[model samples]
Target: MPLNCGIVGLPNVGKSTIFNALTSAKAQAANYPFCTIDPNTGIVTVPDERLSKISALIVPKSLVPTTMEFIDIAGLVEGASKGEGLGNQFLGHIRATDAICHVVRCFDDPEVVHVAGAINPLHDIDIINTELLLADLETVEKRSQRVEKLARNTQDAKIKTEASAVAKLKATLEAGKPARAADLTDDERTASRELFLITAKPQLYVANVDEAGLANGNAYTEAVEKRAAEENSQVVRICGALEAEIAQLDPPERTEFLESVGLHEPGLDRLIHSAYRLLDLITYFTAGVQEVRAWTIRRGTKAPGAAGVIHSDFERGFIKADCYACEDLFKYGSEQAVKEKGLLRSEGKDYTVKDGDILFFKFNV
Candidate 1:
């Protein structure tokens, strides 16, 4: 899974700050507009307690956790669709991501100037979303122009199907709705995927609050939450400054700091986990004496597809998979115990991999 989420919003809304905290990559989070001109991408390990538990059980020499990528894209302005403030470059970066994390400023700090001159989350969200919608509209229109001509002149079934999909997408984008909202069949969706519309990607709204507003959100966050509900999206509230400071501490000190703050975990962990789920991804494990490793796969991936995440040879020579739920391990206390209790399963290619599954792949290779 090379899939990644793009952190995007108007300038000075803590997109880079959150990104820097998320990856601890030092992406130059300044209090100025367009500070991040180039997209900064970082690989982040997904926090999973099961990985540690599996390591404890197997006593592996190495514990490898699954990872996901995050891209910090430059902020978008009001006229982004018309190339305002390097908008074209920024939009291109967003188009390449699998999902979106729109960071909305919910705290009013006079020192950190708001790009729109006020902390209005709903307005800010509309600005970025409108730009994305406009960009998608343009893409659909351009693609429709070429495809429509071919579909009318030639009776090719493939060309006609593509033209129909393009028309549906154009109508949806023109109405200020995302292409994802359009009623398209499976074949039409397959055809429309080639368009690569930014608005078609799943999105999560990130409400960046001050420390005081982290536990109970402010008015701005409430507004963001309301809008997200209307759009059937999720919102994750985080204190950007606090998380940035937390990112600088050692592991032990970090735990102490969080405990002192009356918190169990840093808010960045929740944000990372939310972004991972936004991609509709799930994790499965391979535990052994050599290593206890977590692997990422899409939600409905079959046994062979899950094995392919390890190596192509595993998929090619796949025989079957010996699998058991991690919860079964927790119950039985050992693999032998799990097998004795008849909790282990031997699944073939048709078996869909479940999250937290402990798998021993059987492959000739």
Candidate 2:
């Protein structure tokens, strides 16, 4: 996985608008479909409510949220597989992403043109998914041809394994199933994982709705829900225009705005947190008066690998770590109290980190 998601949808589906709101950077948003010719990449901070609480308790020089990468891909169109309307170029960008956030335009706007000439969520999804299937089919078929030669040769074990994996993947793709749907042995999966095929990653549909849709997600959301149920995918309904406005407000005003809208938090926060969990990412904190920062790591990250994210030296000379869960601090009110309560623990390199752990690393260098 690339540790990032790519935003994709048909032209004028508010992909760029959402991307700009995510990064708070201008990425050339225009009214027309395919206005964004090139992909715009952004690093967005993953918002955590716990970070604010932690900051309140232990004041730091700065509070930095863990970040994730988002790429705004050019809009994909029907007949894209046949190279219609810059489809081929756009598809290649999506293939490089770890996950896909398909932004379906569920809002009705006479001023903004719909690329498909109507506002049909299922039809739009099919157009994009069909193109992806076609692209993956091309890949599987091409790779299968070369692997067929090696599958018959008994001399090379590596080649034989690869050939088998490719054959399985080819069959899965031919059945209109994604590469991720293919069943492979542990070694085969490990070998094939590096291919970074687009269809192999999970997907979530983002219903870009209007104001009325945001409040209760009108008929458009219902359509998306039905489609998601069929595909076993999830839907996140948000108003892109509203989120963009919220992103511009100051902290205090932002909160006020959310309350006014009867929302507890910005929809972007929910979307980001959902993406974090979808990617199986967790945060562990390193806190001190000097700096208290959140670091992102895979869910099962062991001590050394988590430390390595800070610096190579931390892993290279790792001795042990002094750790206590943040929940312990919240309960005990202070580190000294945590120690007095016997909640603090000294862990060795083998310790697998738990979410909300506050760690202080010890090293030789």
Candidate 3:
């Protein structure tokens, strides 16, 4: 239930800097390799304007926003799969995460050191991805070896299928492709999941640019974006140092700084939103005068499953949910007006919670 994304890249790609900006935490951003030995975990509030709008109408004494966790993982290096330079430890941290934020350096500054000697965003991407694929290839090969041994001794169809699955995975990984790009059937995919391949996790690219490159991307950012498009991944442009400065300012001052920089909002917000989507997550609300709060759930989750996010008992005593759209309330100016127009309705356990839904649960327990 505690889903998180691991920020990963080579050394000094602004991974820690962007993380520091996102969480405003002092996680140590030194211009050197392996500065972050252990992954630094930080919880950040997921921004949603609907939460404030819902609070305004309901007049809650306290309002709470849902959060996502970000893990600033140690930088990966070439030959990481061969146990090079704290690679195994960092790769383990990445495996624990649900998704990945692959940070790429799209800026050049004399003060920051580049791990690859020069900026080649494509080569940087290839290095990190190759390491992950190599790691997964080893895992698949090992799993395949064990499964093949089992296959020769038994006539179990399931075991044979598993062996075949790992065979396919091995071939894909051997061909320098991630396990996700492998052509697997349903059973094969299920079998592949058991390996917990690092390459299988969904990912988005973060182009850490300078202040000038933020508004209009530079050549480096363009390269990163093009590479992301080729891989069918998303790219989020962020100026790490500037965002760190913006994060320290007061809300009023932050707004002023943004306007002065020709930005309507912080780039971190875009990064957060992109990561949320990469995880296939959605937010729903529970409204009341006591506390209006937002909750996170996977897309296409049923009402009972969503209720389970709050507490087991809510899901145990399953019932209907009274739900309305936050946008409807905003349009109508009040919840009463929304209800008067029949915008509110009761939904059964089969109801699929939406991103902007305001739900009121009806449970016996």
Specify the highest-lDDT model's number.
1
Q: Rank the candidates by lDDT, best first.
A: 1, 3, 2
Q: In terms of TM-score, which candidate is stronger, 1 or 3? A: 1
Tens-place lDDT per residue, model 1, 1-365, is 56799999999999999999999998988888988999999999999998998787779989899999999999899999999999999999999999999999999888999888888888899999999999999998999899999998998988899999999989988888888888898889898898899999999999999988988898888888999999899999999999999999999999999999888899988988898899999999999899999999999999999999999999999999999999889877899999999999999999999999999989996
Q: How high is the lDDT of residue 108 in model 3?
A: 83
**Top TM-score model:** 1
- Give the winner by lDDT: 1 or 2: 1
Clashes of 2: 0
Better of 2 and 3 by lDDT: 3
Would you list the rank order by TM-score, best first? Answer: 1, 3, 2
Those runs of model 2 whose alpha carbons end farther than 4 Å from true positions after fitting are: none
Worst 10 contiguous positions by lDDT, candidate 2: 189-198
Greater-TM-score candidate between 1 and 2: 1
Error of 3 at 25 (Å): 0.7
